[model samples]
Target: MGQRLGVDVIYTGPSTADASEQVRILEDMISRGVSAIAVAPNDAAAVTPVLIKARNAGIAVLDWDTPADESVVDYSVQQVDSTVYARHMYDLLVQNMGESGDYAVVTGGLSAENLNIWIDEGLEYAKVKYPGLTLVTQRIPSDEKQQLAYQKTLDLLKAYPNLKGILGYSTPAPIGVAQAVQEKGLQSRIAVVGVALPTDSGPYLEDGSLDVATLWDPGKLGALTVYVASELLNGRAIADGQDVPGVGRITVRGKVIVMGPPSDFTKENYKDYTF
Candidate 1:
């Protein structure tokens, strides 16, 4: 998309969950005098000041996937409304678990704004809509790693043998949880649901280890980020309900731009998508 827009784009990400590395990368981008930057922050607070510096340097800052501090960025692009999406995921888990047992959440990391918000809203939703379900643990960090999540899930299973379901807020958590469940021959006992690429979760879904995986097109997200950055760079106004290339029509609320609905991958449909 940047190539089509005639804009030079450079992509960089921290090797681990290090906020300081993200800050350093932003500083490097500022020093290089890039015209625009689109980022999914690892830690919103830690990256805010550097984002401000980038904006002050006359560069357009676009926040994608995860939002940074709103005051420092021109716009935020998200997959869907966080509360709504969380409730939907929780509802699916409750349905699979028969709506009356203990469940737990595995999160990407505690500092991840979007994942934290999703888990919080899902917990709130469960309290109101599915009162019979009990949350077994507070949010547990997975470091966004499948292996770590797998280990943590095994520990949870050993600690709570009656665990009915597991909700994963990160992409890898559900896959890891499913693996743990499958290894223990408990697929029929514990349900797993989360945000995952179909390619990564297909085998688990097919074997009845995973219940559901939900996500938007990440390729579309990357394209939309570049498209929106180009629009801002060319002095184009982004209004509510404006059609963004590859993302469909998006709604602008405050400085946030929401991409359309999320798609769910089930056992029957997981084979259709590669990501």
Candidate 2:
């Protein structure tokens, strides 16, 4: 897609959520004469200087999925907001858990801003609305491991014997937590919810170990990001509530793109989704 748009995409491979690495990738991509760069920033603040340099070099820089620096970025595209998604996740968990019980949250990485935002939003939402719901623990797995999430859930269950629900921030986190609940023979008491791919979560849901997971249309997110980048490259001033071609209608609020609603997955409708 970058090549089709006359831009070369320099994939920096799978690196840690480190800012220096992000900067290095941007510098390398820019030095190669890439007219525009779309980045999924690992560290939001660490990559700011290099992104600033790329902007100064007349290269358009856009942040996709995660925003590095709103001031320096021409635009930031997201599939959904953390708070909105978190509220939805919390509501589902609370409703399933009878809206009052001990709960815990498992996260992908402590330093990943995007995941952290979702965790924060979910935690805050739970605290405000479900005052009786106590947070048993907040665990962030090393290397984004499902096994680690499982272990953390087990530990939380033992430490807080009243734990009734578990909320995860990413695809793997929830799946891992559900697997742990099943293994510990606590699935009957504990409910699991998070952002998980439907195919990967189908078995868990079928077994009644998981309740709800959120999914988004990646094709739509990618297409919209590409379209918005093209428009910004053409020197169009983006305003709030502008429509992008393939992504649907979007509104720009602050640094976020606000790409509309997220799709939910449950046992009743899980078969209808594949990704």
Give me the runs in candidate 1 sitting further than 4 Å from their true place. Answer: none
At residue 187, what lDDT does model 1 achieve?
A: 91
Candidate 2: misplaced stretches above 4 Å?
1-12, 15-20, 238-243
Q: What does candidate 1's lDDT look like per residue over 236-264, in tens digits? A: 98889998766789988988888878899
Clashing pairs in 2: none
What is the lDDT of every predicted structure here? 0.88, 0.77
lDDT of 2 by residue, 90-142 (tens): 88887788778788778876767778777777777777787888876555553
Task: Provide TM-scores for the models.
Answer: 0.98, 0.88
Q: What are the RMSD figures for all models against the true structure?
A: 1.0, 2.4
